[model samples]
Target: MILKRLQSIGMVFLFLFGLLLFPIRSHADSAAYVIDETGVFTSDQLLELNDLAEQVTNDRECGVYVVITKNMHGYSERDFAEGLFFNYDLGYGLKDNPSGIILAIDYNDRFYDVYSYGAAGDTFTTARLDSLNDLVYDYLVKDDWFGACKAFINKCDELLESTGYVYHTIQYTDPTIAPHIVETSPEQRRNEFLLRLPFAALGSSIVGGISVMVMRGRNKRTGLAKNADQYIVNNGVRLTQSRDMFINRTRSVTRIQRDTGGGGHGGGGHSYHSSGGTHSSGGRHF
Candidate 1:
């Protein structure tokens, strides 16, 4: 009985030691900058965005990281964003206080937050971050994950470049648009043409049918008289009086309304302070 009791105690101690030694690991450092835990990005798109993030960080000397997960582990949007930025150890700035920005998106919760640290917070004002959200909100609503992420990166890069931190960096060209016209690839144009072909063919067929019906009606009416004029002897009747009659005429004018005031201005900018680091604004929810 004593031996059995000792063995049981020993097994309990061993189990407790195992539990202490093999605690669940946090996913904090599992990714570098962009983490798509929900598989929101395709292979090619993920590669492109990761490359973009790396390039931007190297060029600007500040981290522009993105984290896309299914949930935020019960933290609020802002807290999750700030926590991730710190836990991930993102930023290339000074050792004392790192500088960077992180865009955290929780797919399951349909929540997104943009958190900035150090110099990034100073550069990315509240209004500017809101504008960035504006660029991506519609795309996100439409489930265009890649488009939304690309927009976020593009806008961030542009804003960073504007601050003179990163100068003369080549911009990301949106394949969806050029100067005034939407850019269309050859395959896209072909697909469009193919999609409209049936409609065009139907329209042509309808017009052809109408023409044929009109021709048949005309054939049936050939040489037929609707009045007694055709039956009258050639040049048998003569008119003595000829006069012109005036009809009423009218015209219409459209009044054009002009905008009387210039564009309205916006309100004051705001920023959030987190753990002594000032972050930008905007938390989007679906």
Candidate 2:
């Protein structure tokens, strides 16, 4: 009984070991690539590309394949052609050879092309191509691989809608004429303001000081003119009131001069006399 129990245990252990080995083999088989001279790709590169491809395919809920061709080979070549094979001679084609999507990276041109076997061909420029690669690296490789791939494909679809496939072309223009940047959220704006607050505050202080100085000079000139006008008006009013009775005295002097014949300026023998009392105006006159 003891021997039988040990044998059963050994069989159980073997079974578990085989179960573990199965996944290892399956993974190895599933991840296959075709590397060649001028392929311009390393094992790590292929692995990364494969990971992105799998992510896109898995999210679409459709079977898709990613194939990289050295010097753009697959564009005009067939899967069964000689010297055309993936890792372990596994052919590079749509899943089950059915109509599907394929993301082909041409290492030679550093350009990427997306082809829907039965639909259309879309191309990406160097910058946009780099953006797609970055999206794969950042989102697919680092974050949710499936979600990133799906989002990328969706973006490609949106691009296609506007300019068909030509939307991938890059526009070179003067940086000064570039469109206004999109506004950021309040939090982002606040952070930006804080980052630039020192310079902004310094500029505001300079402007404010200059404005205050100008206003002060203007007020001083205005006040001086206003005070002089008020003084002149007050003195004129006081003199007029104090000299009201002097008007009759001035008339009497004028009559006396007329009676003494002093009005005849051409008479050489004419004599003029002055009044003994001196009249004074209330305000000093120069």
Candidate 3:
């Protein structure tokens, strides 16, 4: 009995010691600033970038999101960024008037786009975004993923600190502009359709369930009251929710511009619009 007790104590101490010796691992997706879905960065690099991004985002009151994915999710760079931003709620200010920037990179396509919204758009103007893109172009081209991310975070901090960005009251026009002019190949459209079928089925199931419940309720009522206090009590409330599913190959466009923000090497032929808002923006292939 004495020997057994001693061994049990030793095992308990060893477990406690191991707990202190090993580091707790964290899931990368839990990190909001830098989401490396491509898994290219090491733990140390991700930790460093997350620290820097968090610090700067707090200081500037504008979020800096870096999303490096394997592919574009069958959508354009602009749409991917916009959808992720709103869907994930990636901004610093109010929901309606959010302020942030996203550097979305499609690793397989070797393409990247910089998108900014609210005050960040004005702060990171066409000129600023262009210059920012140029700053990371070389690093991306060379496959220096860590260097590119660090440079991106640092450059955003630099621009936000500077006081030269042009700010104007941009009056947004019909944000409903035309669909993408480029013809989406049949193969791409088919892939998008396949992706949406599950959602369509889910919606149909919900609507059918509601209809059946309504019909059953009517059948349960055998006779209607016809005297005093015959009126319905109206004590209970019924709520219904529905969503529209649009599966298409149309690209969103924003042709209006208010401020060019100033001085850059990269040129913008047409301004880009995001899916969630009418923010001023720009983009290009590396």
User: Which candidate tops lDDT?
Assistant: 3
Better of 2 and 3 by lDDT: 3
* Residue range 158-187, candidate 2, lDDT tens digits: 444544432111112221212212333232
Q: What is candidate 2's local distance difference test score?
A: 0.39
Model 1 per-residue lDDT tens digits across residues 120-223: 76567777767767777888899888888777887778778878763221212222212211233232345466566557757977998999999889878447
Model 2: per-residue Cα lDDT at residue 224: 35
Relative to the unseen true structure, what is the C-alpha lDDT of residue 27 in candidate 2, on a scale of 0 to 100?
50
* TM-score of candidate 3 to 2 decimals: 0.52
lDDT of 1 at 50: 83
Give per-residue lDDT, candidate 3, residue 233. Answer: 67
Could you give candidate 3's per-residue lDDT for residues 1-286 as a string of tens digits? Answer: 9999999988996786455333222222357788777788997888899899999898888888888877776676567665455544577766555678888787888888777766677577767777878888889888998898899999999888885443232323334323332333333355456556557757877998999999999888678657855464676445587788989888899989878776433434324344323322445566
Task: Output the lDDT of residue 222, model 3.
Answer: 77
How high is the CA lDDT of each candidate model? 0.68, 0.39, 0.69
Clashing pairs in 2: 33-87
Cα RMSD of predicted structure 3: 18.6
lDDT of 2 at 105: 39
